[model samples]
Target: MDFRTQTSSLDALSGVNADALVLVLAGDTLPVGLDASVAAAAKDAIKLGDFELKAGKTLVLPRVAGLKAPRLVLACAGKASLKSARSAVQSALSALKSGGTVHAALAFAGFDSLSEALVEQTVLAALEVSYVYRHTKPSAPAAPKLAKLSLLLGKDDAKAAKAGLARGQAIGAGIELAREAANRPPNYATPTFLAEQVKALGKSHGLKVEVLDQKAVEKLGMGSFLAVAKGSTEPLRFIVARYEGAAKTVAPVVLVGKGITFDSGGISLKPGAGMDEMKFDMGGAASVLGTLRAVAELKPKLNLVAIIAACENMPAGNAVKPGDVVTSMSGQTIEILNTDAEGRLILCDALSYAERFKPAVVVDVATLTGACVIALGGVRSGMYASDDELAGALLAAGDAALDPCWRMPLDDEYEEGLKSNFADVANVAGREGGSITAAKFLQRFASKYRWAHLDIAGTAWKSGGAKGGTGRPVGLLTHFLLSQVR
Candidate 1:
């Protein structure tokens, strides 16, 4: 579909002359069809509520014979308000999305006026949100469908609005690309493969990128992350992406992502059923990498440090077993009571190591536990934080980005879930209130710095193939980073 801006209602006439839908704002009766008499009759029909036209309502008119009224559709924008106008456009778009087959155009209300940027941003947001991807397991190639979209704005307004849409669409395309990466199969999206993918994205976007292999991970004392990777023949991978768009003196915002590319419950060993979906376990890291790609392209005036602790967690002879104690970079020992509780093990060292970068703030994302999914369901992710102000900022950013998240509790009472007799903490507690305990474990590693943990277990990937790739809260990570700039 070609979603472009049209300057005036007259520009729409040059396009395909099929049945068209022109959304008009209702006010005092307006002329419709070819003759003034015909327009008067149409007005009478509207007065009689034949088409059921009302303020802030949508009325679809059948084929007629006027330049703009032949297939005229009236969508009420109450009293020429900006919000109402935007609502009307969105309603029309929703109508189109829900199966309206018309060359769509929004015929402007000649009396009302709006800024080009506002119009462009509104339309752009609508178009981006309305894009529905159709992907099925049994794939078939077919011809495309045509559902053209046009906005009739003033000449100057059209140019500015289209430019705004162009910019927004570019960023959205990057986001969609990352979402697809997050949706790929486990075998196809291994740690090494993702490392290469991030390297490619970094190079293209003019950001600095580096990857540390298994040997490097061991050398850097990433014991917890390495323990999980020990069972898989596939090399463990750790990636760092840096975006420098501010002055050298500015402190950077750091993003840490748990990239367990494929988790099979390690030595604890997951059940045989539904393990294939572990592919999307790396969604958090993919979102972080995607944010780097977008920030570099958008050239936001900020400094960023993105880290992906990428590895595969499988059950093999070499895998770390239960009751094993491992010392992290922070010199804190953790007892591995259940190897399935491994994401925090990997992320703990990652979060502690981030201290070297001297960041003003740090945020970590992970699909850490099913407990989070049990608590929040699939629509919203669980948010845990050590700082009240940072949590507030994140909540606001999530709302602004339309990547909804709910602040989950991180009470001190849950701290006992991680206490161990010998080590500093145990990997897992009993099944009761598991999500809060897992968060409590990660909180121990984020001392001093303002940090937030996003548990994306529920929102990372859907079970029965949702229409879109990836999920919400993925964008929230990027949105949070962008919000932190000065």
Candidate 2:
């Protein structure tokens, strides 16, 4: 979509002879000048004629008095209520997609002082909602269609607004990358293939990317991450990407993602039911790489790093067995009581290794626990943080991105659930509070820094592809990192 700035009235814009012109009305509104053309001069006693427009409503006006365009779209901007304007914008976008070529003009004449950020967000929402991805499916519903987008600002203060559009496009592209990765069959999106994807993303975005093949990961003592890959012919990979765009003195913000390109549950086999969705086990990695793409394009004044522990867990002669004890790089020993609880196992080593950077903050996102899905359903991801500030920041960032999140507790008592008779901790705690125990397991390695964990099991992939991949934490995480730098 293209966004252009216009500084003219509706009447003056009639000469452009464009496809369509969208007029946005702000407030408890009424639609006026519907039948009139751009060439028609305003009359002193024109009748509004019960054309009262409601807040958060949109009406299409066809062929006004003197304009060459075939139709005129009037969108409502709801009362200057908190976040109501955003809902109004979303509604407008939905309406705009129904019409053919979109060239919109939002003239906020009577609204109270509106922030530039709000405008940017509104515009971003419109263009974003206009897209649909249904190419491969045979019976996919036709997504909404639009060719171009134009925003007629009430004021000529759109200099800061362009960043929002750019960020939105980058984020959308990142989401597509993740969706494509998720859409691929497990045989194709192997550990090696995922590693290559990360490297290509890095090269395109100016990030320094590195892939540690199996030998290198073993050398780093990534026993648990490597163990998951032993059963697959595809080799394991520890992918790292660094973006040093901040001051030399600043420590990087580390993001560790669990990348099980495909999970077969190894010796601790999973039920046959719903195993097909295991392909999305790598959603966390996709999100991390996608956010990196956005951060690279935005180039916020902060150093960023992404560590993805990539592998596939399949039952084979060499696969790590249950009751195996693996020592993480941090010297912590974990008893693998259940092979299915492998995400935390891989993340443990990645988290420990992230400590080498002495980062300002460390956050790890994973499709870690089914318990999280039970707790939050598929709408939101469960957030567990060791620090109050990081947790608060994540919730606030989530609000800004319109992807809401709820904070979950990480009580020290849950650590007891992970107690192991033979090792320092057990990979799988009992059934109770499984999500909290998983968070506590990861918290062990992140005890040194302000850290947060996002268990994205419920939010990564949707049953209805039309809902689109929730693409959850990436938007919130990217916004949070941007806030840190600004």
Candidate 3:
């Protein structure tokens, strides 16, 4: 979709040329700047009980006497806030989805402040609602015809609006990329396919990309990562991608992603029901690629590296079983107590590999544990960071991007559950604080650098009717990277 800023006075709004005109409202009261005729029409609608000032509520007026557009949409935001603004945009777009509306001009009627955040959220909401996963399902309805979105802002807010629009568009594209990759069926989106996708991204963005096959990973002594791949015929791929916008002397921020392309729980098989959703186990890898695409587009003056341990975990005759022991890239041994707990296994090796970058900070993203979904639900991703400053930056970035994360404790006590009699540590800990224990396991491999772990099991993808990848933490990660720009 195309996004642009338009400066128009309230009196001139009726003359703005577009297929639809969207006005965001805070209450029943009409905005002060609306043209006399437009204000009268809006007031009459409210007086007649046709519209309510509730968040996410929307009403459409068609071909009003003085309006140039064929339709007028009143999107109730309730108040001037980012969340409300996003709802208002989504509601407005939803109202116009069926219509042949090709372009829309969105205006904030009673919003007291027209900030960059408001514009950014508007773009994101529109793109999100506009997205349709048609790759596998050919019969799925095509996305809406809405192609252009104009944010009607005051002249003073134009600069901020432009910046926000650019950022929003970049992030939206990245999100779509992540979602598409994650939504693909495991057959089509195997570890090799993911490596190919990253290679294509590197080619398009002029980044350095490397794909290490099973032999190379074996040579690197990523026994923990290989253990998860041994069950599947699909060869494991260790992907390392570098985006260098800074000099080589600058230490980069490394992102490690758990890329279990299709996790069937291996020998510790999961229940048959809903096992198909395990295709989304690569959500972290997808989000890492998504963030890399966004960063490449923004061209931030900072170096970034992505490490993905891509493979599949299926129950086979040779699959690693409970009580099996394997050494990681860091030379730490792990006891595989539960093959279902495979995300952490691959991530530990990838995190260990990240040390090669001599990174300023390393943040590993993974759909690691179901306990996180029970703890934080889908509202927030679980975050565990050893460094307070890095934790604070990520928290602030999540807030700014509206991809929120709640910091979880990294207390030493959590590590106790991971102790193993046969190995240095156990891959599976007791059920208590499962998410934190997973983070603690990864933390062991990341001791050489400032590190944080994002457990995105709950937030990466929705289930049931809305089942698909969410492209989460990409916004948070992108914002965090941009914040670190020198």
* Model 2 alpha-carbon drift over 4 Å, by segment: 9-17, 23-27, 31-61, 66-68, 75-91, 94-99, 102-114, 130-145, 465-468
Candidate 2, lDDT over the whole model: 0.75
Checking candidate 3 for backbone clashes, the offending pairs are none
For residue 223, what is the lDDT in candidate 2? 72
Please, what are the lDDT tens digits per residue for candidate 2 over residues 159-272?
644665667666666666777776667888888888898889887878899899888887888777776678888888899999999787899999998899888788999999
TM-score of each: 0.80, 0.87, 0.98
CA lDDT of every candidate: 0.72, 0.75, 0.91
Candidate 1 lDDT by residue in tens digits, 324-433: 99988778899999998889999998998889888898989889899989998987888988889989988987765556689989889888877899898898888988
Q: Pick the candidate with the highest lDDT.
A: 3
Model 3, global lDDT: 0.91
Cα RMSDs, all models: 5.1, 4.0, 1.0
Q: Compare the candidates by TM-score and give the number of the best one.
A: 3
- Going through the candidates in the order shown, the clash numbers are 1, 7, 0
Best of the two (1, 2) by lDDT: 2
Candidate no. 3 TM-score? 0.98
